[model samples]
Target chain A: MSQALLFYFFAAVAVLSALGVVFHPRPARALLCLVVTMFALAVHFTLLGAYFVAMAHLIVYAGAVLVLFLFVIMLQGAGAREIALHQRFNIIYLLPAGLVSILLAGGLIALIRGSAFQALKSVDGTAENIGTLLFSQYLLPFEWTSLLILLGVFAAIALAKKDAA
Target chain B: MIPATHYLILSVTLFSIGILGVLIRRNILLILLSIELMLNAANLNLIAGSAMHGRLDGQLSAFFVMVVAAAEVTIGLAIAVLLFRQKNSVDTHEIKELKG
Candidate 1:
């Protein structure tokens, strides 16, 4: 009963913050909403028995990616008037988008509910078990992740570098 | 105990919200953030499935997805910064020079 309640609470927060991310007029505030959404997701990860992923989500997403978003917004001086979102208030566009989104979501939920996934066993999902799997069965992807990060760091620096004449 | 279908329903809702954000929002940064939300929804699915199946593969994939998300955000923000420097605005509609 408690688990079900927790899921409902976090899911509501996540969905609301996600709405704020898209519909909020101010970019900075929208970014904060995005952070809230990420934290809520991290909690969901914890509830679902993925502790390691929960911590990683908090660190990488709520910690790093959202901070990057704030940094850029601050540096760019995204003013209230400039990012006012007045121009994007077209009902014609929103009406169709809303209709399609509802249709898609309804169809998806129906399909998933109808599927048979009840007999599956639950895993421990402890950090040690994930670590062991990372080293043994998923070693190749682990190394590739490191290389991908290295490339990203370089690419970010190069892209944000002040152009030299 | 919460059933897996509940989690799946939440994931689907979040994913739809992300899609709406990407489709309707004009600010590139918000659009990117929406994309992150969508990715997070996907991660939630992977973790939930992993928990249900008694397997580690879903968590492993979620780990990799996080890595790629971090990288994608870095590169995307860098480009957003570059765009701001040249254009002085990050509104998607303002960027029309690239359209052929």
Candidate 2:
């Protein structure tokens, strides 16, 4: 019962903050809202017994990725005048988007409800187990991810560097 | 124990909101954030499945998803920065070179 309650609370937080990320007018505030959403998701991960994943999510998402977003926003300075001029909400666009999202959620929920899930057992999501699995069964993909990260670093540097005239 | 159906429902809700954000927001940063939101929803589904099945495969997959998400954000933000440098604006509608 308590697990259900905890799940509901965090689930509500995740959904609401996610909405904030969408509807908040200011970009910085929207990013903060996304951070809250990430925190709630980390909690959900913990509740689901994926402890290592929960920690990694916090570090990778809230720690690194969001800071990158903040740096970019700070560097550009999303000015108020620009926001007021271009960020006005349009009901025509919103209406269709809302309809589509509602349709998608309804369809997915209906499908989920139709299926029967077996009883759940809490998995061991310890760091040691994940490390072993990463090194053994998933070693190739794991190494490939390191290469992907290197590529991403080079790409970011290349794209953001100013060209000399 | 919470039912898997509930987790699935929550994931669906989050994913839908992400889609809505992507479609309605004109700002490029918000669009990228929405994509992150969608990715998180998928990660939630994977973790829940991992727990339900009493295995670590789903968690490993979620880890990979996170790595990919990180790389995606890096590339995406770099593109956003470049766009701002060229156009002095991060609004999506400003870029229409491919509208033909």
Candidate 3:
């Protein structure tokens, strides 16, 4: 019962906020809504027993990313101006979006039907098990991924610099 | 009343909205935010699966997903800012003036 209630609540919030992200005219309001959405998602992660990841998600996305987005929006001073409507490619865009969604939905449905998707009972996705697997089996990927992130950061700075010049 | 499918469906619904936002919304910043929403939906699925399977793999994957999402948002926002400076608008539509 508790799990069900949490699922519905988070799901509703996620849906609503995602809509807000698209429909909200003001960039600041949209970004703030995204932050609230991220916080709710983090709470959902906690309820699912991924306490560590949940906290990390909150810190990185809501704390860091949202702040950065807000900073950019403020620095740019893009508010009070109307966003241009690029409706020319709407039809073309819908084709890809619909196709992608259908394909993914189909694949997920197939996988669920062919596999066991029953609700797990207290599997305890604790930080310890995550650390163990991440370092042992997924160690290479994890470390390399971090390197990629660093490179990505440098790339962003490079791009920013190029833009500035 | 909520079954595993309930969570799955909800996640998919949110994911679709995020996807819709990315495709239809013309603002680069809003598109990036939508992408974040989509990533969170995937994280939701990961955790929900972990909850159901009694395993830690889902959470582990979710952890990795979170990391990737952070990196992606950083890069994306940087590009968006650059675009903003060049075009004077974050709207993706007015960017037709890009020179090869």
TM-score of each: 0.92, 0.93, 0.86
lDDT of 2 by residue, A103-134 (tens): 87788768767877887788878899999999
**Cα lDDT of model 1 by residue, B1-100, tens digit:** 6778788888988988888888888778878888999999999999888878878799889999999999999899888888888888887878898899
Which consecutive 10 residues in model 3 chain A have the weakest lDDT in total? A80-89
Please give the range of 10 consecutive residues that has the lowest summed lDDT in model 1 chain B.
B1-10
Q: Please give the lDDT score for candidate 3.
A: 0.78
Write candidate 3's Cα lDDT for A1-165 as tens digits.
886677678767777877778777777888888887887787777777787788788888888888988888887897535554544125467778888789778977987688766655676656687788889988887998899899888988898899456
Ranking by DockQ: 2, 1, 3
lDDT of each: 0.84, 0.88, 0.78
Docking class of 2: medium
- Per-candidate alpha-carbon RMSD to the true structure: 2.1, 2.0, 2.9
Tell me the lDDT of model 3 at A106. Answer: 90
Question: Which candidate has the top score in DockQ?
Answer: 2
Candidate whose lDDT is highest: 2
| Chain A (alone) TM-scores for all candidate structures | 0.85, 0.87, 0.79
Each model's iRMS? 1.9, 1.4, 2.6
Please, what are the lDDT tens digits per residue for candidate 3 over residues B2-100? 456666876787788788878977777778888888888888888888888778888888888878877887788888888887778776668886656
